[model samples]
Target: MKELTPVTIRPPFARYAHGVEIPAHWRIVQTSGQLGIRADDSIPEDAYAQAVICFEALSEILKSAGMTANDVAHISAYVTARDHMAGYMRARDTFMAHATRVPSSTLLIVSGFTRPEFKVEVEVLAAAP
Candidate 1:
């Protein structure tokens, strides 16, 4: 399996890479959008708590695919409230603390989610060597 490379253009961009190159033989795993529902099927009231749960769910999906956060190539985050951005970033950074490489990321602030209680949703794409 070939290694994944993060590409940056001549001009400096944002904190994330402009693009990422996945090797030909590597397996890709794309996860469905994850919400902040806990094991007891309870949703958190605050954005920060919800964001942490969402990231945890994403991590579990990556583990099931035989990948870790380091293998993540891209991430998409959807938040219901713009004010929740800081909380979401904290959750994401905590989860990615051990990441070998940072993945390209996109954040969208939408009106609401399928369930109004859910303030954040996260989806991920990972590549396995």
Candidate 2:
């Protein structure tokens, strides 16, 4: 994947690329949005913890498809409120910490999720040869 950050436009505000380009021949893996719920059905009260769970689940999904976080091309994330943005970003940063290049990212503020306690949800598109 190629990180697209043209010098003509303003740079990304956070730890991500403005866009990403993947070869047409490369295999791609997309993950559905992951919530914070644990296998035991327990939800953490803090947004950070919740976001961590979301990212972890997404990471595992990528692994299942023979890809890793470094193969990610884009990320889409949602938070229940604006207050959760920081926590969600922190988790995203951690998730891409080892990536060779950061993927393009989009974050949104949503009214809520299926469960009121779900503070964040995340999804990703990844590619590999």
Report the number of the highest-lDDT candidate: 2
TM-score of model 2 vs. true structure = 0.97
The CA lDDT at 76 in model 2 is 95
- Location of the lowest summed lDDT over 10 successive residues in candidate 2: 59-68
RMSD to native, candidate 1: 2.8
What do the candidate models score in CA lDDT, each in turn? 0.83, 0.92
Off by over 4 Å in 2: none
Q: Residue 48 CA error for candidate 1 (Å)?
A: 1.4
List the candidates' TM-scores in order. 0.88, 0.97
Tell me model 2's lDDT, rounded to 2 decimals. 0.92
lDDT per residue, candidate 2, 32-86, as tens digits? Answer: 8999999899999999999999988998898889888999999999998999999
Candidate 1 residue-pair clash tally: 0
